[model samples]
Target: MIAPRFTAALACGLALAGPASAGTSLVIDAASGAVLSSENAAQPWHPASTTKMMTAYLALKAVREGRIGLETAIPASKLAASQPRVKVYIKAGQEVTLDNALRIMMVKSANDISYVIAEGVGGNVENFVAMMNAEAARLGMRDSHFTNPNGWHDPDQQVSARDLAILAMALMREFPDYSDYWNTGAVQLGKQLLLNTNGLVGRYPGVGGMKTGFVCASGFNVVATATRNGRTLIAVVLGALSGTERTVKAAQLLDDGFSKWGGGYTLASLPSQGGRAQSICGDVRRKGGGVALADDADSSGPIAAQAQDIGGNASDGGRFATAAAPTQFSSSVLTRLPSGKISLGPRAEMTPVPVAFGRTPGSASAPLAANVTGEADSRVARGNAPVIAPSAPVAAGLFGTQTGGLYADRGRTASGNGAIPGSTTAFAPADSASTQPGESSGPMRLQGAVRSGAAAPASLRAGAAAGIKPMPRPAARPLLVKPSPKAEPAKAGAASRKPAQAAAKPQAAKPQARPKTKPDDDA
Candidate 1:
């Protein structure tokens, strides 16, 4: 039922003055499913990584039903390894616990981990998707349909802003105990400190849990839930031009819900405001590089796959806008939000949750930790935990395990920018380059082996002594400089005349006999 206050506002000509030009925005009360305000709430749009919300809901449901356990070990199958970056880079046969996988998928928006979760929880991708669609229908997400586990672009897969609110509400209400999975601000996986893709997580005071998503086709989208004064609200913003816009808009929606707005109607009652956003990549590419190029490699969660131009440039600012620049938000976007200010203050210091590869310790099925030692690579410890390499045998197995696996160090000089492991180059999210001001600059390059200047492990030295050859240095490519034309006029004229004579006569020259050389000449 539509709330009286909302009806009064609309009747008083407070309906949004124009069509929702900035994609869609919907604000709703978490407790009642009553929508406080909305624009284009019923319009179908791509969910992007926000699709992971449904993926998480279903996975948690499986856990509650004993179909899967949080500690269950799942392998990154060949299919998972083949997924593009904004991933944990889990290769086939490598493993992570279900708990850590969920945390990484939510915080880093890792596509491959989503695939592992789908396979672990639902038995396979196809079956998992069927389960997703079934759950959407059950939850009354009438405008939502999922075709893959990660929200990769699929023309056929889409969800309305209202549908997403429904999904978010369902996740929070049904699985309140597991809200940490979505609410977490950062994840420490081995040495990589992966900040949550949703910039609002630590910055927004009441920002509890939810997800952010993007694809050129979808623009920047987020389903953010926050609480203040005991009232929880969910905001869905889709098709924002940049991550800054997405964060600011969602923040404004939540702020309004907490203060001035009262419920007007149930989310289902909102009528469709028809129109679709022009693809950000299409617009940027057409403009010859106006905005940050969307990460063409980002697949929404593992729940949907759409064949679209998913490849493009990285983001403008990293995923979250650094607090250093308050000007990142455009005035055009600021005008749409209730408070015309960018409320994203400095990022809050989050105690990152640790997530490690392979199964949890002590499980009967867990692989035994090998005993070989030296400093483990920085990436072996979860979160900001102390760096500890896996035992030598396990470390050897993990580094460069796949054709393009975790090891990016093949020909990398002491500086981090080295040749990537495989024949194909990896595409990281635009923001992957700079998540925060002081954090690692190159999120895509995971550090393998010892840090620069560190002594090699004794085992490694012994291996070299035992005749194992280290990677050969890549040869420097020779530059070919064309010889300058001779200064002699006679030679120039002769060269030109020869070309003309050859064209006119088509004569074949006799082969010259091989010249004999003295020992000195040969040497």
Candidate 2:
């Protein structure tokens, strides 16, 4: 059952806020939660992928509360695997560690992994969404509701800029230890460089972390956090015309907040506005803006070479690769504030947090969704991961040892000593990275062989894997039977007149010898 407070809040919001606004923006003092600036901040609008910030917060809360562990295993259900693009594309039944799933969900803004996380935390998506609503009400998010894990479009799923600032602050205040998850600019997944969707990370000075969201209805949105001279600020911008616009707008708000100290209304005291964004899907310029929250993780060319570096193929590279310059170019937007400090440019490069599948190497508890074969304990004990295959499951001991790609430098055990054990399995080491303290750092013995950037070679490509599977050939169609035409009734005088005419008809000519070749053959 939904929380009564949440239900009441939803009813009140719907009754009072008739429609959302075209856009909303807010800036606040992170330490005090004091509102610095706001524009339509109380207007409800779609959250888009920025919804993942709340999801990340809940997962961290669960970990802190011991409801789940960082090493807990979560399986990607059919529902998760079937979610739309901007995902890691883990196949149904494939498992990921909670630590890695959160990193992927935050940095990559993966929709599918969000579902996997929802299941891991709340046992399923429905329960998790309920938890989200309850949490929102408890946090005093007066104009917010969540219907899905990844913030996919739903008319009912809405959040105000003020509420977004509140949520961002909650994540910071409650889980300061897990701050690395949101701030990291990228995470190397085997051969792929998964950069954060928020382009301000490495580019804008003092920009620490946060998340970005986008869809046609929501335009583009971001909840960004930054620190400078002992001052930290949270900026929320919603429903911009493009990705760059949203980033720039957030930067401008942050700059203004920094330039001018706060004397404005607090979040709770802000006036409530009734409206929603006018649908922008029909705008050709908005559609063609070509900015998306989802990055092309599988594209070849320069990104492929970068993946090779993360896979330990680059001469100057090591087990893990840091976030490098963006592969594509973006226009820089200058700040309009008096301080002239923060500006929106290309995504800044920084060292990424490492993530992998399976439990942390030395953890005591078994994965939440361990193998059904009752071999999870033995397999994890021996450092063997489940191998992913396109056709069918393979026998145990066939998957190779995980590489010392990017990982936390936990003291290596014999199995963790970067040596492959005696086995007939053919597997490649996955991506590795240096991790923040308390994150999963030991190398994973992932099941299935994944090349750089490619999760399951055949099953995890973004556009290719998320499409409808091929159908079996339809049965041969039955031949149609044409009914015989009914005989026409004879005219009154025809029966008598036909006998003489038929008798007098000239004899039919004799058939000539058939030609050797068919008549139409030459023609």
Q: How much lDDT does each candidate structure score?
A: 0.51, 0.51
TM-scores of all candidate predictions against the true structure: 0.58, 0.58
lDDT, candidate 2, 454-474, per-residue tens: 432122111111111211111
Residue-level lDDT of model 1, residues 72-92, one tens digit each, is 667678997777555667768
Error of 2 at 277 (Å): 5.9
